[model samples]
Target: MQTQRSFAKQTTGTLYLVPTPIGNLDDMTFRSIKVLQQVDLIAAEDTRNTQRLLKHFQITTRQISFHEHNTQARLPQLIATLNAGQSLAQVSDAGMPSISDPGKELVIAAIKHGIPVVPLPGANAGLTALIASGLAPQPFYFYGFLPRKTQQQVAALAPLKNRTETLIFYEAPHRLLKTLASLSLAFGEDRQIVLARELTKKYESFLRGTLAEAKAWFDQHQPRGEFVLLIAGNPYPQTRADAYQHLNLHDYVAQLVTEGHPAKTAIKMVAKQRQVAKQEVYRAYHQF
Candidate 1:
């Protein structure tokens, strides 16, 4: 004989994925605050930052610090609470948890233990920029943030240059200009780029144009606050008569392969940076 679980009677605990305001408290949803209040525990990436947000809504829910550094050690403890039949919610300092922050590992653990995971939707800067960037919305890649070093950052963006879908990158104000310079090197001077700075804040600004034009724009304006960089999708394949002059694919792939990407991956990467087909790169690799 077995008993089936019902919506109300089951002791099976639930995990709520709540989204917090990225920069503005007004963006916090009523549903988010309600869930925060009712949950047995709140797992936060930054307990200090969460404290500020919680205080604003008068939420007194107990919070446990759960961020990248402590997530591995903290998962088992958090899961034990869930297994004990206590519902919990996880949040980041801002935006949805695990988008580019903590929450992925914790959510996976809860699922393995048969705990239900629910999403309490709210604001997200990534989607905010994508929607307002006025670029192709259906297909896009969100590159949360780049490596701090200029060389490493450029190598990271190198692989995304050829993706036919819109690309997004999160950058701190201090690194915005250097990041843009790296983008121009990988994507080309004429590539279209959109910069959304201090979004949802008092000094929100959008600067858009070719990479060269954008570099000039930023040179004059001092940047301050969070930024979302949206680079337009790659251009359509070129016709023979209209083919534009560009760097040779083989030489480019050889260079990147030397920089540590495997030969196959390098071919694909260079194709992206050159905005051409993988076959274009493959042929060049085999030629030399």
Candidate 2:
């Protein structure tokens, strides 16, 4: 139960989480620029990339690399700098830090050390695409970048198939087709999906259609840039009984295992669904 008064005067330095433009440079906010200029040091995901941004805005702040590869190594140093009462600003290569980038670990460390964490809101690809997706906006689940492997990806998406809120995901161009096929497999081919590419850039475009249609379109046209995928929620969520009414306990558990759940986990799930003892479901599954 910690409260952060962002602007309150404190002995320790503040950690500012700055969000950079996702694509278009013009989208960079005035406050973000000011903070970048004012902070004692900037911890960037990629110093090279951030240097370009700093040069564009004429910000001369010095930077230190703090990406996924070096997060553990850099955490102590950054935390010590903050404790020394030197303000720090953390930024990713693009968009908000820690959304699908580095900064979360440092943020946590700062919080634990009682450093104020001030976040300056700015560009985000997920919300930008969601608004124009023509889907329900308020209730949204942002699942950034699915697992690359087919089985792992399917397992990750299986539970999300029944969500009523809109689903948002980030995907690279090279793997877009594979992800689209997986989405169709898990959430049905007819599910409404919007693929927004090169967001906020000159080539930014949105393709709204059923999952199958989106897959077919991408099959013909090579996917070009980073994509923000928005999937419409399950219109008709299945009930427990309705979902597995046709299958016996053993077969139902087997199906869950086929979908990537471990056999023990699948049996537990079936037992819970059937309102029976775990031993009953386990025995039934092992019998056949």
Candidate 3:
């Protein structure tokens, strides 16, 4: 952790970046509650949202409104608060602040002035989705949210279409199907996808399939809530696709296992790389 020297000029207080729950109030951390109560000030993306959290925790700390519209204006005031040795905590409407949320600017400003920034972990929609996505978690990138425009969005995904690392994205409900359609066009029907919607809420759902399958699901059912889209990485180079073409799926998994990966996980790895059904791999394993 980088300790801001300017933080030493004052009594050495921290700017805690707190994570709030996306859905359930019970997910708030005890440490977060304690910090909120003890901090000199709390800056929230939405005062009303934070107010409810505060009310639930019985915290009465003075809160200043800071969000996208007013964040620039509040930067100086927040810096001054930290320089004066007053502890402050920053929160978005939900989840950790500044991760596709507001407060990145404030965090940067604080660092420029040498104010200590501490991140307290709690609920995060991306991590929540990735954990259950059943995709390769290692070597993955977190792309917060994609743009709404069809061409722009397609262009955005074009660069990452062939990355070997798993990719995660946050998306709005109304555009979910459109985004899926664009992905199908950009990555092709065989691209493996995992769609996590309404996470951590009563109507939570998980839809995992090929790009074509996900598009069909989206068309039949109206999406609800914020969504996290996880795409299994594409095998690099057109030549990379040649490995399993002649090997059949089982031999591919077996070869992967011979190299090192466990048989079960290797099957999944091969499935993602080939963008085929795991059942096909299983059948191949037994027949030959």
Candidate 4:
């Protein structure tokens, strides 16, 4: 319930969520540079990595480490700095802070303590890949990364299996093939998906095809660089006949439970398979 007028004059120093170049240095925005230059301190995920960007722009601003390992110890200090009218900018190794990074807690603390939070948009890999992904961009959902374990990844992707909007995900090179196979299992082999890697860099390329083809391609080729995966959403329409065939929501949950699946997990899977809200599925399943 907080409103932030980014440009408004304020007594306390603002907390800036600055986005760094995902791959190309030229993608850094002019406003981001000015904010970084003006801020009292820069809380970077990796000071060593960020130093390269700072060196490129000749920004001599002091930086402090604020990564996943040190967030618990550093969040309070960052909030205190903002309260003291000393502006601080938070940046990840690349792209936006708090997007699978370590700034979400600090930002939340700043907001709770009445400190202004300003976000300067510059470069992000998700949207950068999505626009050129040849998928529907407007109604897209950005899921930062999937679970590492195979079972967990499958469970995490269950609810998203039937979404109408396009889906976005981040994955490392080593796990690319396994993730593609998992996607094929969850969404079927024929679903369309695109893999954009080495984005905005010299070797940047986009691999587009069905999930099966993607799995095959990666099987044959060695994966390299970070990837932004965009997958087409479920296109199948649910029908009343389909509902009857599945023995209704209650019976479906009961059937899943009888087969040894946890009640909560079963409800979620059923909800996803039926293309309905989880809450709706929960209520209907629980209603005796």
Most lDDT-accurate candidate: 2
List clashing residue pairs in candidate 3.
none
Compare the candidates by TM-score and give the number of the best one: 2
Q: What tens digits encode model 3's per-residue C-alpha lDDT throughout 113-216?
A: 77788889899998898888899888889988888899888877766776888899999988888888888888899989998888888989898899998888
In model 4, which runs have C-alpha deviations exceeding 4 angstroms? 237-251, 254-288
Q: RMSD in angstroms, candidate 4?
A: 4.9
Report the C-alpha displacement of residue 113, candidate 1, in angstroms: 1.5
Candidate 2 local lDDT, 193-240, one digit each (tens):
999999999999999999999989988999999999999999899875
- Residue 84 of model 1, lDDT score: 88
TM-scores for candidates 1 onward, in order: 0.81, 0.90, 0.79, 0.86
Which pairs, if any, clash in model 1?
none
Candidate 2: deviation at residue 55, Å?
Answer: 0.4
What lDDT does candidate 4 reach at residue 121?
81
Q: lDDT of candidate 3?
A: 0.85
Q: After superposing candidate 2 on the true structure, give the runs of residues whose Cα lies further than 4 Å from its correct spot.
A: 250-288
The order by descending lDDT is: 2, 4, 3, 1
Candidate 2 residue 28 Cα shift, in angstroms, is 1.1
lDDT of 1: 0.84
Please, what are the lDDT tens digits per residue for candidate 4 over residues 155-186? Answer: 78866777888999999999988898889988
Cα lDDT, model 2, residue 190: 98
